[model samples]
Target: MLSVHTSPLHQPGTGDAGGMNVYMVQLSRALAELGVEVDLFTRCRGEARPRWADLGPGIRLRHLEAGPRAPLPKEDMPALVVPFSLALLKEERRYDLVHSHYWLSGQAGRIAAVGWRVPLVHTAHTLARVKNAALADGDTPEPPSRIRGEHQVVGSADRLIANSGDEARALRELYGADAGRTEIVRPGVDLRTFVPGRGRAAARAALGLPVDAFVPLYAGRIQPLKGPDVMVRAVAELLREAPELRRRTIVPVVGGNSGAGPRGDAWELARELGVSDVLRHFPPVPPAELARWYRAADVLMVPSRSESFGLVALEAQACGTPVLASAVGGLPTAVRDGLTGMLVHGNDPVEYARWLRWFAEHPQAGAVMGRAAVGHARSMSWQTAAARTLDVYRDVLCAERSGPGMNEAGATARSCLADASLLEGREGRNSTLAALLS
Candidate 1:
């Protein structure tokens, strides 16, 4: 697996790290549980680290020196793809199939796969065209060069993996991807860790939230794309439009800054709206701790302008917390409207504020939705996701073997899947390095 830009080992909710990091981490670990040897290659930045680090029983993260020995802005990643690919070629024929997460990795993976004569499996994670169309306020547009790169990847990859049916359709509609080559593989939640039934009162108290406060939590990277500003504005809108709701309402934003997500942007917006006292922000927390925040909230808010799979919503649901998300991208798939939560249309703060008010005004209804949310979450397990992904790997592998002129990479993929006995294992994990790097 190629994650050329960011390593799965990096902490999420920070610059250039979010769901994709979590997705890669969790998915790889699950694949490892299924007995698949996952050799994940990524860029080396920061302090000098080992070339390879054991992620799990069957997973290893290999750091390859590319650009600099420190993290660089994602905008500057394209120039390093070839260098990364060249570095990877030194390990020619070391593995079977090459799977890439995100476009940068796809570019690098494509070059290596062709050189090694192996098939390439690519997951866009989030497409440039898709993001550019739904860019948040003050967010920079995705460069045309990225669109060209993605177009090349879409055309060259043996298989395109989409986190949702919506994404699969976009691949066809946006990049003209072949439907036959597309795979719809949904992301999963950690049921054991994100389980429900925690005492909301104690959770709130532990998290420094008001014991009786109607908390609406927005957890994820605090960026324009994630719409942290929109969330702040909505809470303020809710309070200003209905001052009585302010009596016990509080909006807690959980996450770190990313891109132009200035550390104080959201806070300043809150202050300007004269709602700073009611709107709170915090650094990102580990999953175990985040579950408490999810359990304590009346509704988990996802105001993203666009999303590929909205993993945060699923995590919140797993904790018996209903989500109030923007009806964009895979958020509709994540939050089952009326059952798990409501999906407000457009980026209108007023629309989100309306749903927030409804949840605050009807606590019993929210609780009932939360119960249903748990059931929904439990159904989408990492075990199931892993098994499904293995099927894709196997199908691609076996198919390649059956065809003429197979390359070393194809042989590798086929050989890896040939372990019929290992296919029986259940699972999945994702993240830059944590989940994939697990």
Candidate 2:
């Protein structure tokens, strides 16, 4: 598996790491559990990381030097693709297939698969065209080079994975990806860690949240694309309408600055709106800790401009916390309207504020929705996702063994009935360097 830009071992909710990081780590573990030997490759950023580390019983994480030995923005990643690809080709071990996450890795996979004479399966965690269309104000547009790169990857990949049916349709419409070559795989949350333990009161006490406070939690990177400013504005709007509620409401943002943007943008907005006192900020926590934050909240706010899939929403729901998310991308599918959570159309603060008020006004309704959320999240599992992904790998390899002429024809026929999506898992401890790296 080619991760290329970000390491799966990196902590999420900072920099360019988010759901895709979680998706890769969790899915790989699940695949490993199914007896698949996996090698995950990423560019080394000189964080004192080893050249190679064991991720699990069947998974190895390898770091290759590319570009400078430090973090560079995603915009700077295209230049490193050739170097990364060259590094990947140096591997003497043989593999049956190559799978890549995100476009940069997809580009490298395009080269590596050709070198290895293996099939390439690419998952575009977010498409340039899709994100450009839904970009928030002051957010930088995805470069044309990226769009062209995506088009190239889309055309060359032996098979494409989408996090939802919506994403599959986007691939078909935006990049002319063949429907026969596309597969929809829904992402899942880690149910074992994110369950509602000890209910809301204990969670509130553990997190230092007021027991009677109406908490609306934002738990991802604080970037413009995530619409954290919109969340701040909504809180201000909610406070303006009901001054009394301000005393009992707390908006905790558990993330850090990310993407190409200034630092403290959301917090600056909060200060400007005079709602800074109502806001609390915390750096990203581990998944087990994150679940506690979810359990403490009345509703989880996911106001993203464009999300391939909102894994945070599913995680929050798994913690028995209803989500109040923007009705964009896979969020509509993630949060069932009027059931698990409410989906507001557009990024208007007034609408989000209105929903926030409703949840604050009707606590019982929110609790009932939270109860329903747990069941909704339970239906999706990483084991099921891995089983389906293994099917794709087997199918691709099987087609390859049958010869090139029949590969496309066979893959196209079988993909018609495939149903697969995204999955989450536990983060593993880093392993010692292996003899292969030495």
Q: After superposition, how far is residue 90 of candidate 1 from its true place, in Å?
A: 1.4
lDDT for each residue of candidate 1 in 200-282, tens digit (9 for 90 to 100): 88788888878878899989887778888889889888998889978898877788888533574777888899888887768
For every candidate in turn, the CA RMSD to the true structure comes to 7.7, 8.1
Best candidate (score: lDDT) = 2
Clashing pairs in 2: 184-420, 185-420, 185-421, 185-422, 186-421, 186-422, 187-422
lDDT of each: 0.82, 0.85
lDDT of 2 by residue, 1-438 (tens): 999889897778988889999998899989988999999999998878676798879999999988999888888898788778767877889888889999989888876665566788989999999999988876789899889888878887888889898899999999999887788888888878989999999999998788999899999998888999899999999999988998899999898778555665788889999999999989989999999999999999999988899999999999999999999899988899999999989999999999999999999999999999999999887878888888888776776777662245224422421321101111110010011011
Task: Report how far residue 32 has shifted in candidate 2, in Å.
Answer: 1.0
User: What is the Cα-based TM-score of model 1?
Assistant: 0.90
Q: What is the lDDT of residue 110 in candidate 2?
A: 70
Q: What's the lDDT for candidate 1?
A: 0.82
Candidate whose TM-score is highest = 2
